[model samples]
Target chain A: MNEGAPAGAELLEVRGLSKFFGDVAAVERVSLDLARAETLGVVGESGSGKTTLARCILRAIDPDAGSVRFNSANGWTSLHSLKEKELVPLRREMQMIFQDPFSSLNPRMTVQQILEEPLLIHGERKRGKRVAAVREMLSRVQLGADALTRYPHAFSGGQRQRIGIARALMLRPSLVVCDESVSALDVSVQAQIINLLEDLQAELGLTYLFVAHDLAVVRHICDRVLVMHRGRVVETGTVEDVFERPRQDYTRLLLSAIPSPDPDVPLKPLDRATLNL
Target chain B: MTAPVLAIRDLAVEFKTDTGVTPALSGVSFDVPRGQVTAIVGESGSGKSVTANCVMRLVQPPGRITGGSIRFAPDAGDAFDVVKLADRDPRLYDLRGGHISMVFQEPMTALSPVHDIGGQVAEAILCHRDIGKEAARAEAAQMLERVGLDDMERRMGMYPFEFSGGMRQRVVIAMALVCHPEVLICDEPTTALDVTIQAEILTLIRSLQHELGNSVIFITHDLGVVAQIADHVVVMYQGRVLEIGTVRQVLKQPLHPYTRGLLQAIPGVVPPGERLATIASVVGDADIETPHPLVALADGRQVSLPPAQLRRVARS
Candidate 1:
């Protein structure tokens, strides 16, 4: 480990990450790291194992092999080997934002209930403090305190996403994995959520593992981006470096596929240089 | 002179929720030339999907096309008034998947799980165009083949679950095109798809549009897709037209702030070592109560009044 690295260095690290379902390899040899207060973007097509990587990181599903090392307030711990009970403290330090805001949230629970559940489960604070914390978080996400009474269905896709963010930030986790958090949102609303995430990150010193299929959104928000293909990290670079000087064929193809606003301007023809990486 | 393939004049759509009348679209106007791709691009709730649904007469209850005329110009001198026809009219049914067809987002729900792949496409062909079951099967196979599917015979008998998302979308496209409709409306057809598959589907749509000479209305939030396929572009915002122009004009040199923001947000444009531009502020950027006229930029392109200028009172 680099000695001069920040105290929150390597908030989460994946080494040789691999998962398989029957004959299909869902994720293979995928390695990435999330630094403290840094945003790491994971981009890929469906079946590219971006979600599986997220699951493995969150331990929502156990990986077949590999290690996930997380440096929390309690020091570094390997997440892959930890059982549910052993992982509880670590879970509190890391949270995930799901893709579909409508479906991921419980229909029965009010927004306040949803936000407070994690704090309650961790026994981090008393019920009264939890309510105050929930209200504060809601405010941070630009939601009203009165919204606490309403269920997720009452909110629009973008608003619901804000609630999701509020819930993720409730515990003051070392890292947050936003898995397609804005995919369901409209373009304008997506921008709002992206901006909110950025602001919260700055204010809270929160780190993000922003997973999404939309390269454009990833480009805007992510400090560093990893492009996954068929369950492996195919390309890794800063947003500008990876997008502008894509070193892989799949990356080039993805870049070319983005719907251009200019109908007359065909995608810049791919030269042989882009294929070698 | 030949009539325009699709003409919507002063179109207004509204949905009656418990909250009251929520206007979804108002005075949205445009025309799609035959054999061309006309893209309706916007953020969510921009009424792009609503407009497409209106074309199919598929807007569920609680939503109504309150006003507007939709005229469809078929081949030669043939023309049908779309808005005048009631949803129950046989002509609407005939037009759907016959004269005009649609490919929707989320093929899992769009395709029937109960029916086999072959049965579904065959049913579409047999429904409007009088054809035998065996003949329909052959045509379905051909359609699947045209959509770049291999081993059509075996795949046809399989249910939707067996196919991958991209393949299923292709099947949906095939179903839409099996009858050679005069118009194809794709509502975020590739949104659920992965990037590479999206590329393939986009390529397929572009090629098919060229080969079949069928007009297409592509409704998507993705500006890249509009750039790739659309000749004409229509940008919508909060139930009204924000801007309409050629794809080149709308995308490369976007006049509308929303459009420009969207384009700048794309990851591909960010130079190495630079952070992407994220537009901050409220969800609804446009003036909801009034029709915000798009102004002509210095470059002779159209742009909606920027959110800053339009929201001066709110900002203050």
Candidate 2:
């Protein structure tokens, strides 16, 4: 359930999105919609085209077919048809956070530079205004002003992730796609980041496309979930429905495979009918 | 109680970095019961991996065992202290892979890209046994089949790159078990795999361990994995063993505050709309008060608490 937006307005809508690498259809005929301020989770195994779908939406990788319609401040914009130069301004409306905190951020740049790069690129040339924006974004992510001068190497995995989150939100984007954002962190740190993401979503009315392979993490944060298998969407439903009463056998297998933390509770057996050997 | 197959007592390990000697493990003690899966669980920098390295005597240079003994008892021979054995001692050759083998987290790197599957598996067998190349290859083929690899004959010729993540892991398992070692150390063996593949690997390991009756040292950070597989769990934090008990005792009724913090930190276990309990909320600041005393909770779970804090709680 999306909140804080107009009753029926969709933040993002995808129609028959597809990408192929050689003979492999990395993402095949995928369609999904995201309401404003809603967190739509895309879940699948490593080769399940979840990353391909995210990249296609971000236009980081060009897609072979289909349309990505975003309801921008101006109105609905067709992202798929736009050229590189035309897509430059629209890029400010959408941002992405990568999985590996260690490698994602430019190591040589200070936190201020990393956060301010986007604003500078989007043509905010005033030094004072850029620094102010950077400081404000840092505090929003719960980092102190001192972090502005520190390089990415100085921050811990959790802190680096916070910096990543702050950088993604610095541009004040309508939609932020987090690709396995917290997967690299430890359990405690993961919880901290997840909470931070939720808080930011509520505060800024930001729509999120949270992509991950971990079902439990997706269940914890997502409003609705999309399950992908072998480059195709196998199921899509509310988090409760997808997890509890999965329509697809593949979804059930994925849910069952999650190791239960309680020792007293036995592990769900691998459903052979679902697995199909 | 039956004597543990492997008994580690007051083990201390230190890494001699350029800065100084950093303690990796300090006075850690645990026992791997015969034919049971004993999990060493902890986050990064917690020394679980160091413990596994210690068991296999695979700790690289700059890291050394400072104190304590790792006594391993074989099914038919006298118990020997692993710590006392020299790094290159010929006797260690008989112990390392012959009796104690290891499986790593990433199977891609673990399995050689250049070598054929059968050749690698056969090499593991040949290292510990006085078998001919043909016999070793036959044994490797049989092992591959046991690990659920299809078309063992043709599959044996395949390289590591030819297999999927799950299949590569199976190949690694086949290599580790070819010698039928008494103790198998799996260091986050399934962390790189998908959920379904992970389940299959865990099941395969469990069933193989059952049939082979080997003691297993499973190292992982996920409590969910420890729940499904471990018979006994060792919770380590900053090189110290916080809690050592059955899986039920540790997972359901955790003794140590750190263990409790770890268990509570798992997402999706708690009901919706409620914030997941965090270790930061429990531990507060980084510096913990010293000389902690073990306190028994209402549910009979024992947890170490600072004496002054316990007294303050009592007075309040």
Candidate 3:
């Protein structure tokens, strides 16, 4: 069945997706589309199911129902129900970068080992050329060649993240989900990483699902934005549309909750009038 | 402006590394007026924590303040210089927690892992005041209650691990205030907590500041937290003060380019795939060549800057 676009037009799609933990629905009837080479940001507070949805898409955790489909060079395929053998090769088509750079990268492994491990497991790149590929990826991420010999501990928090991004891109995945990638970094380092990601996306034709709680960071990077509250998508629109004119009351509250750089601007007093208690 | 209870002038800190000396703080000067809540905002490695540690004389080995004077106004009219005091002086110990307490970033590591939560809170009270175990326990419970811990008595006996992230922070707050210190230094106290919990904690700190009328030095990267709590803001970079002004002035009409860039870097409250506004250059990368060591403003106050050759100076 031909959808709104051609067979390989859309990069990824989630239709009526829901994840249930016992009796409660973690994600309820969620649907979204990510076009090829687009950066989509997902904004939400903790426990908003943004992470759960990312897990469901990555198939790190299976979704209880609905479908996660990917459009690739071969054809469009549903990822939600794929068995291990079937999904093995397709796993290369998508990858994820976690929030904490410390835990995400193996401390014991040298940067060389960490970079090579993914290419080895994915198997698209030949084993004989893996070293060269590893070095290439390192340089692409703006890291020096000398970094190949260093351990994770030797690098600062920002440098560790560049390595993390390099590791995720080693598979040549079509999509990367950066879940709070810069939240742990200091401000200057965060800016460096953001610029690196932007440059990489332009060069590599990569699409990103940028999930973070920091509104200013989201403002700087995402092309389109969505706001999640509790377990639902309270507001969804282009970054300009949502920030300029948020429709939902909850969206407004979340925006207001964001602290502005102007210290003189009075904090949106927590609406004591609105608190149920 | 109210007279500063804690006045620091020409403050500088140096760490003796194997390669020589690394100047972490240089000519850092500021005033924390009594009854005011001031925020020292900067990125990581900007020496925000070092400034806090210097004030407490908790600078570890190889790290020492080679220069500067930290004056604490005498309650009865005289003043004492903090840097001149010995590291282990009884007076320094006496001032700590009793006159100036601190709450660190991570509550999990800050609290004793083996001790019951109540024991830790009571210990802080016992250190500053002459009190028996029963009296300390009662004070601990009451302190916990003041910091918004419900069922405070029951929670006291529980270990730190058993408490939620927010509750553990509350316990730390209780411990800090157990002695009713005149000034409080909170170094990213809510960094580990969720937004809703952070909101609650910010609200609590504001209320406590109002009630006690003590000065506060809040060190954090989150401008939102700064907005919610700070009466004045200190923007620091590379261990030096970049901009110091009223919170409104810094946020609304930032003078230093670094300050402006920092304000621009906050993510807009929306989802991704949108055009996010970003500051063009990183903080440490910018270079400004100005002849004057300190620029004089219309008010006759001079703002300090690093050397002209140094690339870290903030532009106009």
DockQ of each: 0.48, 0.71, 0.40
Please report, in order, the local distance difference test score of every candidate based on alpha carbons. 0.82, 0.87, 0.80
Sliding window of 10 residues with minimal summed lDDT for model 2 chain A? A1-10
lDDT of 1 by residue, B214-242 (tens): 99999988887888889888888778887
- Candidate with more favorable, higher lDDT: 1 or 2: 2
Looking at model 1 chain B, report the run of 10 residues with the lowest lDDT sum.
B279-288
Ranking by TM-score: 2, 1, 3
Of the pair 1 and 3, which is ahead by TM-score?
1
Residues B164-229 of candidate 2: C-alpha lDDT, one tens digit per residue: 999999999999988889999999999989988898899899999999999999999999999999
TM-scores, each model vs. reference: 0.87, 0.94, 0.85
How well is each residue in A1-277 modelled by candidate 3, as lDDT tens digits? 1234334338888888889998888887788889888888888877788989888888889988888888855677788667878888887878888888999999999999999998788764566699888999999998999999999999989899999999999988999999999999876577668878988999999999998887767777877887887667878988888888988776666666665555556556354238431
| lDDT agreement of model 2 with the native | 0.87
Task: Estimate how well candidate 1 is docked, as a DockQ score.
Answer: 0.48
Top candidate (lDDT):
2
Ranking by DockQ: 2, 1, 3
Candidate 2, residue B284: CA error in Å?
4.8
